[model samples]
Target: MAKGLNRSKLAGCAALAFATLFAGAASADGTVNIYSYRQPDIIKPVLDAFTAETGVKTEVLFLDKGLEDRILAEGQNSPADVILTVDISRLTNAKAKGVTQALDDATVNANLPAEYRDPEGHWFGVTKRARVLYASKDRVKETAITYAELADPKWKGKICMRSGQHDYNLGLFSAAIAHWGPEKTEEWMKGLKANLARKPDGGDRPQAKAIFAGECDLALGNTYYVGLMRTNEKEPEEKEWGNAINVVFPTFENGGTHVNISGAALAKNAPNRDNAVKLIQFLSSHKAQQVYAAQTYEYPVEPGLEPSDVVKAFGTLNADTLSLDEIAKNRKAASEMVDRVGLDDGPSS
Candidate 1:
């Protein structure tokens, strides 16, 4: 409409703008709202891809905590169609809170492993992560390690870890309980606590940082964090922190490595119910599985798929066949054992 515009050019521009607005409007009915506890950077791309593939717009409400509480509080008036989060305990907790509805979809069932999804179908796991070992590149020599070996006197005063109360640690402890029973896991925790390099403090990355500082020679950390730290650009020093150690996917004497899921569930009262199920199905699709795992640095839950190239460098993981459902059942005992063994109290000294 200004000096340079011919009427035809001006009309064309207006038409283009209107078409763009109309395109967005056309997809309004396909919008799937998500209540997610997972960090935005990790899940947004997948959501974007979902929109691109299906014309389904995704609106996310990112929450650091209380996702279940908020959804429950909103009740039937809630717009939350899906809940995206990590950890089996949290998923089980959401189910216990009555915020999620059971989904019965053939595509989801075909894609997710039985061990990774709820038996009642309240959630479907899309990726796999492990609480694996982190050992100093300068000191630890053994390539193969066992979780049981963490308690051996040979490694005394040589290990670093986060608080035993941390969900990451709890996941492992619950898996241990599932594998070894309460009495034995409690004993194992005590001996492992006796081997601490320092008081249980800091998150997983700090454990590797401590190793780099020579405070300890070994640590317990999630596998994905190693990839995140190693590739971190904003915190370049974390790459060095990552380089200081190697991840060891420790296993039980007769079992495979322990692993958990980053998964999503259907909300009980989805405003956009069909679109919500479509979103969940798209998430578990092979393409989404590849993107989600590669971006998040986690292994894909859909079998025959591998984690990103960076995660593969740590070594192949033979995930334990024990159902996460089984591990979840043992969580209460695992938590009690952490307290009973005074794991957070550091060693007996």
Candidate 2:
């Protein structure tokens, strides 16, 4: 398994590598600079493999800061050959801002499903994540529950989740708006807000921890968190956290729970354009995707790549079939609704 990492170094290595190779034009000897939000540790193995296979040095610029803003500031002079990050909304925002350029890669098109990638060739998804529900096994039955049910008076004062302002929560709410419309989505948000056991505070992991501490009967967390806990070699508490819950996929009848991705795009003015394409292709290949899946606990975006064993044990999920674009497009609305409904008070962004 890949070691955990600080987010910034990941960006630096990819971007730095590109800068090193940017001096020439053959693309083979050139480096590929990458601007990424994927923490460095998660992608180190994949990048290392790319370097070993192609002998192309890579540089990365890790930015926890705004990706779109940095790219925009660089304009046509940016050293970035690729932009990698999570969240569909952020990817769409980058495209809208013109920091990303479309690419024609057969490997990307063949491996990733159409919905997971941009309609145009602008970006491609490499992995998937389901925003499933985690409920206390002893306190709650492991039966079916829809996202809308959190608003029911039955769950009032019994729900825990991250702040609504987060990209993940916003994306999930955006999906809600896409499927159920603004009125229904707002209503659902209001109900869910009313039920918050302890204001929406903490990231997915902490939310799960809160459930273990008896802070809430249920919490909203990613599917990977379960796998991380289940497979944790370092933290004994993660195993306990895993054993304490029942993972549930909400609303499979209409559409599955909201899903998102950690995807990539070509930089608008890539110096090592061909190599950038090759790097993306390599990342999307089965071997790299498998490594990514094992490390991050995310589902491979490639159609046929079976999930890592840890993920499979979580059980099959019914994912929302909505195009990620829809979720990204509605992000602003979700953000506003979250603030209006006061879910933003729970966790700090």
Candidate 3:
């Protein structure tokens, strides 16, 4: 019943228990193993609730990078039963790397929208987060904006963002390539690079800090970070950063807001397959979805569930209907475009 465990402690516990936890064969031992890219704090509550209700024990191995490579290297002996990660790129990458297996469950299919889950059943999105514009409240007044508009000359020298090569930006860039052709998307990348307030330097929260400090007038960030920042008791300044800007939902010209997901997949060599399936199914249920909304401030994947009140304060999310599979397909090209433009080199370059 531990709550709010940090990543380091979680990792330590996982390491200690790794050997004994999976010594038995893949049987119904009333336990499930998870390899997760999500931070320990964000997912701990939901996992705890699952165990409380289902009486099935859970063990987690949390890693920031190389989750797929680790699982791949382990092959059939990998102890992982489920993989939890964020963004379409990572999910699709896991599937491509042969680390994930298809999940063909009727309940899971019914719980999530077709666009949010893999068309072939390789992965399932558990929560949705929009890639949004964080505009300086005092300096910018526009209430509505478009993704194409981020490259407009008007925003030059006033935009802050992370590296163009970051997965979050890549997700949006891939969506841009989907909405606009590759040719048009390349030109847009150049425009956005030219608009950089500084070299893409930090995570999404730092972009908000830049806006708050008057270093930039706008920035690109995911919606959940706003809630996380605004409610952060551990860091009072993040609350200020959250308050300094307004969340503007940006859309493709012919589409709705670009959205990404925090999703889960079945490990290819899952030791506890049935329990793993049950865990994923429970995560897709209304109760688990509610924990996601309350604890993480993310939009639940289950239809009809509203996001937390803090997230609701931002605005309704009219998520674009474009299939994530389509967006993921363009990631390689989008990444190439980032390098071609030298987007990480800053605007003055």
Candidate 4:
């Protein structure tokens, strides 16, 4: 069930300031339109809650197609007042393209860390996810390994991963580039590619499944996928999938793993700019943030909200502190390197 929002719990002086700017709805009847890339099943609960509490009947266009491309094509004619999706790289790209506006809100600015939100304020992350390693407990002795170790000779032909072109992979590789200069990171990628157990070919869940089938010893994946597998009520197979591997946070002496996010932005010419701001702020509020973190098995962007018990049971992690914008900015270079080394071909299923 979708949770309800209570304005009484709104935090700090930011709330008082936001109260003045609180525009409930663009239309007289209280409605807003959203264009979302997040799957309907995953995000609908939260949207339902938002609508129920505020009377803001959210009309959504759920597209599996790229949100940026769609918004770009829509141009000024886009009916979208709000944009939602995962991955900092994609949000940063949209910001670069001028598809979203720089939202000026006192509460949003004060509550969100400067690094987490765009410098220009084009977007803010609603929730966070960590990049983690899913290694077979029976095969690997060390419960922990550094990101650089995945390139070691011993790991050669022992690693499983998704397509290098995928945003998550590119984001991790981009972080590697940021940590070490391009040349070393490129060498690392080539070596990592050489070490592939099979051609890198599956989404995170499938890669975890590969480990269960004895196809690989370790697979790169996100923290949330493990949460979903463990908690998904509709699928008994996912419970079996969750049991096959152990989770590891690959800290590169930097002391944490890479983390990404699902974020939101206001459309460039949002007809209901005030209402859009309210909707986004609502998502960032503690109530929505908690629901997002618990439901998605992602880390909440807010400081005090811990992940749900399912995620807590998997264990804890310190996320790599590099600002998401830097990772997004370097994604192009990461993609180029992935192509240069032929990792984009991925493992064959």
Candidate 5:
């Protein structure tokens, strides 16, 4: 496991970037500067291995938010060579922001699937997490469910999920748009909203907690949260939440489950462009995917790389054939649908 840099060092992005200006990691061979939206602990081992393998150390500035904005603000003077972040929506948004440049890496192209990488080569998915249902094991008996079924009246006021506007849900919502078209997706959103247990709130883990508490019978969340809850040490009771629910990789009536990725892109003004490309290529390699899978319990984007045992136990993810770029294209509309349907307002009393 990798240790995280001090959270205090993460306070002010510009100040931290300035502090590490010249004396950051790497040797005379030069280092790759990364501005990551992902927390440090999760990616440190992968970075350490990259440095060990290529002798190119990485200086990472971990930020909870504002990654693209910072890069845009720094313009060509930005020291960042790579942007590591979660969610395909964020990656695409970064590209839309014009802070990321198109990459031209043969290694990355060969290692990752077309649907998982931008056609322009701006970003590539390293790990994927499926959006699956968390159904109560005690109260729910059906082994199978589809994404559209969440709108069924039988489940009315019985579904629990976070905000529909959240990136995870938005990604799934966008997929709905891709599959059903905007008008039908809007109706689906209305149906889904009519089935909510309460005003959408909290992270994915809380939905599991709500299930355990008997507040709801089904929830929507990513596959990894189950593995994390099952293995939680800081909160032993979280294990009960895992025990209370079973994962269902919900498919569309005609397709598969909606999934998202934690991917990375090349900075438009990267000072260490070659080194950055090397690091990005390394992330798609089998070795890095293995470490990434075990550490975060996310599925590897590279074909033939298996997920951790914990993730597999959730059930096989039949990922939808819709391209994530297509999903990304619908996100703004998806978000608008959430508000149009008042999904966060909860089901009618």
Candidate 6:
């Protein structure tokens, strides 16, 4: 009788253990995995909020470069459910590489503007940042400037910029090519090259720093870097660099200012497809949009959402209406024009 009782108790314990293992597996399956080019710190708050609200866990893999390549290498077995990245080049490149898939969700379409999302639903823009001029407060007095004006001889030896091949400049140059044919764009590139303050070197913030040191009177930089600089309590010198310049919104002759985006795409082989869709929808929501604007200092892609006060102070952004698809199409031509015209060889070359 004692032996029978012992066997029954052992069977009960075995069943309980099996139930716990099954529950753990189910819980693990509910997690959404992400591969991102964006820094982990920038997106953590939103991801944390998502977990809290939906009880769906998130796992992020951050990389500074080669995000799409990694996903491609992982192939059908890739654990990536979502992809977060910045710039139209990266977004379109991921599509071209066949690492991203289309997402045709009503919630996403409603939350983001059509112009900001891929027409075929391959990717969606979550935030925008304008590529604007940073003019030294003591040097440049012009409040209004045109993109064509950058090539004028009057500003010779007064401009500073990063590598012409960089994605940011390529995006702007691509927009220029979209506005004007390659011939005219090349000529404009030559003229702009003639006006460079120095060889194309450093990132946007360094260009601002050059202006602060009076090395150049004007510099090309993104809108958000200015906000980052202005609010950088940890780096006091950068704050001074922010204060040394005035943000100038430059437009194409017949268009508005050039703007780029930080966007997301659904992975081609998403394991947790439904959870990934939910995360993408969550990102486009007003709540997530607000968090992006406040944390990244970027303009929200959502129609009614406002940018952070720091960004608002920079001046209004009249973003050009050129389709990002058009820009992506022109990127190769724009890049060829850059190398052919020797734009990166500096003014002296």
Show the colliding residue pairs in model 3: none
lDDT of 4 by residue, 237-343 (tens): 88777878889889866787888999999988676777778889888888888887787888888877788888887788787778888888788899999888888
> Candidate 6's error at 8, in angstroms?
53
Relative to the true structure, candidate 3 reaches a TM of 0.92
C-alpha RMSD of each candidate structure in angstroms: 10.4, 7.0, 6.5, 10.5, 5.9, 10.2
Tens-digit lDDT track for model 3 on 1-349? 3555676577555644553456563454898988899988889999999999999988888998999977765667678999999999999999999998998999998888899999988899999899999999999999999998989999989999998899999999999999999999999889999988889999999999999999999999999999989999999999999999999999888659999999999999898899999999998989999898678788988777888889899998888989999999999999999999999999998
For candidate 5, lDDT tens digit of each residue in 84-162? 9999988998999999999878889899989999989888999999999999999999999888888899998799999
Clashes per model (N, Cα, C within 3 A): 0, 26, 0, 6, 0, 0
**Where in model 3 is the C-alpha error above 4 Å?**
1-21, 24-28
* Number of the candidate with higher TM-score, 1 or 4: 1
TM-score of each: 0.91, 0.88, 0.92, 0.88, 0.93, 0.91
Candidate 6 Cα misplacement greater than 4 A, ranges = 1-27
| Weakest lDDT window of 10 consecutive positions for candidate 3 | 19-28
lDDT score of residue 222 within candidate 6: 97
Tell how far residue 192 is off in model 4, in angstroms: 1.2
- Rank order (by lDDT, best first): 3, 6, 1, 5, 2, 4
Pairs that collide in candidate 1 are: none
Candidate 2 Cα outliers beyond 4 Å, as residue runs: 1-28, 345-349
Scored against the true structure, residue 153 in model 6 reaches a CA lDDT of 96
Which one wins by lDDT: 2 or 3? 3
Q: What C-alpha lDDT values do all the predictions have?
A: 0.87, 0.82, 0.90, 0.81, 0.87, 0.90
